[model samples]
Target: EFIIESRDIVGNQRVIGDDAFVVEVEGPSKPQVSVQDRDDGTYLVSYNVQRTGTYHVRVSLDGHQIAGSPFTAQFHPGLVMAVRCTGVGRGLTRAYAGENARFTIESRDTHRNKTTSGKKPFVVTIRGILQVQVHALEGDNGEFHYSYRTPRAGVYFVGVLLDGVDIGGSPFKLTVDPGPAHANGCSASGAGITGGYTMVETFFTIYSRDYYGNQRTTGGDVFSVEIGGTASADMRMRDNENGTYSVAYTPMIGGDYFISVMMDGVHIQGSPFNIASDPMPRESYLEMYRSMEPTFKEKMEKMLLGGDVTGVKDRKKANSRRGKEAAQQKSWVLNIKLLDANRLIPKDTTVDGTYGTGLVQSSDPYVVFTMGSESVRSTTVLKDLNPTWNEEMKLPVENRLEKLKVEVMDEDLQDEDDSMGTAQVSLTDLVIGVPKMVTVKLKELNEV
Candidate 1:
């Protein structure tokens, strides 16, 4: 509405008089306007618009527009209420957990007619697996847009309020599902991964995760397992119908084995867990013990069972205490006795690696006596810090070698055998017919 006051040509104000007043309105669309002359030198103007916009009003007297008669009038929608407002678009109903979810709302008046908003007229929030606040942006086109995102997959509710009042459908329900898997999201674990044994089966588990870092609820993901170290190694994988997978492998020799696990050609977290395998027992080493004298053999069995070793108590096992001269007499039976080791270094995360958690830890230890092409390996003592192998095996009397290479190693079910230490025992100074106990300290000692 606008008011206009008129004066005479002499600039004298007229208290009561008649004047011809015409009014016109123009804008996005012409509006209906009315003009009333009070016959007292004043005029009143009013207009009604159908759209929300700025409208131009022109008030003229006779043939010319009155002072500032071409005026600007801003128009806006009527009072808006919460019950008439509503959201639009697909994003409001569903979206992935890690991606943005966007939707828009149309604010309306009590009569359900489109309306414009001032600043910060609506409050939004989300609740369910997670609680979060939402910010809405108002557009001149009369739209209130809102967006949000979450890291968990589950059902959620979106609540909207206008002018401190809840909307007609105040809280809307939304369903979020786990997104596609990513290399950074997947993971692997288990006993086999920590370590393994040679010629023995080892196992582990793999977990498939989604973009949001949550394990997927279903399975059927293809995983490839590769083991490297010796030429003969085999790995197997299985799906447990859930997000987890089972893996198993066997090593042919004692060495460091590198394992790589992949899902759909992508590396899982901690893909290559390694293994330090202990020397594998072979039939040839067992065959070497079959020819020893029964008296010496009977004592060895007692020692292996953690029994007392009364070495060469009877003359039946040895002639007398002969010196190096006896070597020339051709005693084909050359015996080497293995005693118990003490204070050996402990290697963590072995087959016993199930430490602290239901998992057992410690090294499976053993001894290997290597001489040229002839190597004899003793039995593996599982999960032992200090192990005893009082067994005596016969070696062929060869004049060529003066020392025997003795190595103490820790056996793993997964990777290569770890050398605890090694020592060379001097065979030249020993008495031929005497049973002796030689304490060989294995370390990085240089050969003389």
Candidate 2:
């Protein structure tokens, strides 16, 4: 059933009279139905189309005429579009009269190149704050169909508008070169070594080139070199004979460096050859030389101070306190990791080896101590079965006391135990003056 409402009068609706409509079908016609009523001086109506195929329906009431409904058995075809250019892609924007910028529109998706689906009767939407002018193309397929132009030099948004709604904002970039002021030749050079340090310098030769590569050898404006790194000052040059000019620099140190040349303050590629330091003398000490050069030493201190290799091979000799006897008496907590068999004895104990007498055992009851003493030591263990002994020990300073010797047998007793393990012991010196502690540990590699 179909119903109709009046747009001129609010809340006014009507049902057509039963005899007021005439319906016809292309093929065989079927029975139709209509309902009609009159209330409060307003008419009301409802009707239904029974048969399919092309049909015509006319509605009239009270001597009033209405438009007939002509129905065709077909689907709705929406909108389509095309775009064209008045000129080639080279100067699309140059064709502008007043503020109209020009551009070439290409299908964003390459797959749509052969598409004729929506080529005509479609809408175009340009997005951007700037005003844009476009011309609709007439043909279905062409390399560049649409011609778009812009008003000025700024970012512009362009896209397709369908059914009064925008599709996507595709971007286009426009660049305009103002052309060279004059021809400027790109040139460079380096600083000379005075004393032991080298310097850097640079210059330029202005040469103008046209869009066709024609050189303008005369009347090119002079540009300056931009200062960077250790360069203390900035300098520029004036055009000399022909187009060559000069600039200079004194490098802070010896080595490879870059001297950037510039125009006004804008950078132009003018980095020249390496600025080198005076050759270092053959027999000079590296440490002395670096120290004399404040900048060099400041850079390499972390590399030079890394290890403690001051010619003293023995640890005891290294930690010896020669001048003050009271300070020499200071005690350090040392971790003496003994051979597993040796842990039974107290750590830092002195161990003297009698090679011919064979292995030493924990039962030797040796005194444990630091590198400086013989008489001062910690409590000792009596045997291996009673393993693990600990004590704070003191060392003597009169002799070169590097190794914390573990004495297995006293010279007077002449008795040595044979159960010592086969692991060799390694001694590492601790840093001096840093109140440090040492722990002696033991691990048995080949279990006994």
Indicate which candidate wins on lDDT: 1
lDDT of 1 by residue, 330-365 (tens): 445567766566556777552322122234356788
Q: In model 2, how large is the Cα lDDT of residue 114?
A: 28
Model 1: which ten-residue window has the lowest total lDDT? 350-359
List the RMSD of every prediction in angstroms. 21.7, 28.9
Question: What overall lDDT goes with each candidate model?
Answer: 0.68, 0.36
Candidate 1 stretches greater than 4 Å from native: 1-79, 109-113, 116-120, 128-130, 138-140, 220-224, 263-266, 278-448
Give candidate 1's error at residue 301 in angstroms.
16
Candidate topping TM-score: 1
Residues 311-400, model 2: lDDT tens digits: 332422322332123233445344443221222332223342421223433354433343544445344445343333434454444432
